[model samples]
Target: MNLTVVGLGLIGGSLAKDLRSKGIAKHIIGVDKNPDHCNKAKELGIIDEFQPLDKAVANADLVIVSVPVNATLKVLTMVLDLIDDKTVVMDVGSTKSEICKVVENHPRRKNYVANHPIAGTEYSGPVAAIEGLYDKKTTIICDQDKSDPKAVLLIKVLHEAIGMHVIHMEAEEHDRHIAYVSHLSHVISYVLGKTVLEIEKDETNIFELAGSGFASTARLAKSNPDMWTPIFMQNKKSLLKAVDEYQKNLQEFRDLIAGDDEKALYNEIGRINDIRRVLEGLALKRAQGN
Candidate 1:
């Protein structure tokens, strides 16, 4: 397949690397607003060449829009408009509802698929593009029925080629579930980092006092704000609800701690501990490459 990647950042560059390495995509044409990223990706062999968006998508068998959520709205539309009937396109935006809704009535709507691959790290740029990032990860293809069957099949083949498990879902449902599991966690991480930074002015003290637990919890705080800010805004409604619930739980825990209700606090901890089993199962599944 002749693939065109709209953004040569982590997601797009990673996808290009895996697909090219696995022989799924014959050639990759990169398109990015950043010339430096495009050059870096080509230097790293993530993409074969770079081109303007119009020229890139024109000859592509498939185009992957892996830009930020806010930019994806415009890029995806441009890709669809430029591509021929046979050229399929997919977007890797985290929030799906807004993206899917905006292009629902487009003339080439059937040529596009909405995807959110449950993979990534607190990094960006082409240098961060590594092979096997999608290995054993879950990718949700939202509103599959709305897209052409051929396009959907091609997208499934592309993701599955990179060792990802594909599942179908509605766009709205994907956003709601992702808000709690993904978005809320990011909010917590960023805030946790901010809290620590504010309270612990001494960098040496933080480095000495912090353990692995703190490091892991605050890892996502290093993620690119350019990407995450748009995601938070796109799913604002669902994220607000998730944040509200999280605040309520935190309040309950604080009240119990303040009131010296040891039994209630212990019970709450015990109940939350049950998540360990679920997390273990998930970890096992990923380890086994399910």
Candidate 2:
């Protein structure tokens, strides 16, 4: 297969590496606005060659776009305009609803598949690309009914090739769910990091005193703001709802502690501990895939 990846950053570059390593694609073409990423990706053998957007789309049997959410709609529309019916276009963006709406009425909408690969590191650029990034990860294919069956099938096959389990969902639901599970995590981490940094101004050894738990909780704070800002903007309504719920929980916990309601606090923590069961099940499913 002739596969073209439009953004040669972490996700796109990693996909190219896996597709080539697994012999899924005969040729991998990359398109990126950043010359450094293009050169780095080609030098690392992540892609066979670099081509302009139109030229790449014209020659690709499959086009995988992994750009930031803000640029996704524009790049998707441009690629859709350039692709033939046989070309299957899929985007791996964080938020799905707005992008789906952007091309809802497009003539070539059937050729496009919208999905989110629930995987990545707190890193960017071609240099950050790694193998097995999608292995055992869950991929959410949104609004599959809007896409052509052949295109959707091709996407499912591609995801399976990289060892991803597929789930179908409406774009709105995907956005809402991810707002809590994904975006909210980032928001919390960023705030946590900001809070620490603010304190570090007065306490010089604040970071030095940090433990593994703090590092893990603050890790997502290191993610690219350029990528995250657009996602938060696109999923603002759902994200706001998630934030409100989180704040309510935080306030309740604070009141419990202030009132010395030890039993209530213990019960709340115990209730939250139920997530361990859900996560353990997901981990088992992923391990079975391996």
Candidate 3:
């Protein structure tokens, strides 16, 4: 396969490395606005070479877009514009509803596949990318019916080739569900980190007393804002609703504590413990996947 990856950051760089390692792509080309990133990608041997966006995608068999969600809207259109009819395109953007809508009426709409690889770390850039990032990770294919069957199958095969579990869902539904699980968790981590940092400015003992639980929960705060800000903005409609729901739950817990309602708090906490079962199920799946 001749593949072109548009953004040479963690996701794009990782994909390039993995495809090459897996022998899925015979020649891999990269495109990025950052020459430094391109240079780093070459130094790391993540991509064969870097080319201009138009030239890189011109004769490729497939183009994998891994830019930020906001940039994805424009980049995807631009990629579709450059590719020939046989080329298949996929974007690994976080949000999908708006992205799917942007090219809904394009002549090459059927050539594009809307996908989100549910994987990453609180890091960015080519230097942070690693092979096997997608191993056992879940990748969602949204609006599968809209894409050409061949394109959809090709994307599915590619994901499977890279050791990803595939799922299909409507783009809007994918956005709504992801807002609660992925976006809301990032917001919580960012806020939790912010809250502690604000307090730490006055009381430096905060980190000294912090434990692993805090570290784990706040880890996503270290994620690149350039990538996440666009995600939060593009998915604002669904994210806002998720935030409101989270706030309601937070207020309930606060009220319970303030009211000295120990019994109610105990019951509420116990009820929420059911999430442990769900988590355990995910753990079992991960173990089995390995």
* Error of model 3, residue 202, in angstroms: 0.7
The superposed Cα distance between candidate 1 and the true structure at residue 248, in angstroms, equals: 0.4
Cα RMSD for candidates in order: 1.1, 1.0, 1.0
Candidate 1 TM-score, true structure as reference: 0.98
lDDT of 1 by residue, 1-290 (tens): 89999998899888998998899899999999999998898899888899999898888998999999999999888888888898999999999999998899999999999999999989999999889999999999999999999889989988888999999999999999999999999999999999999878755476677899999999999999999999999999999999999999999999999999999999999999999999999999999988
Worst 10 residues of 2 by lDDT: 13-22
1-290, model 3: which lDDT tens digit per residue? 99999999999888888889899998989899999998999899988899999999987999999999989999999988887799999999999999999999989999999999999999999999999999988999999999999999999999889998999999999999999999999999999999999999999777889899999999999998999999999899999999999999999999999999999999999999999999998888876774
Best by lDDT: 2
Residue 218 lDDT, candidate 1, scale 0-100: 97
RMSD in angstroms, candidate 1? 1.1
Count of backbone collisions in candidate 1? 0
- Residue range 20-64, candidate 2, lDDT tens digits: 888888999999999998899999989989999989888799999
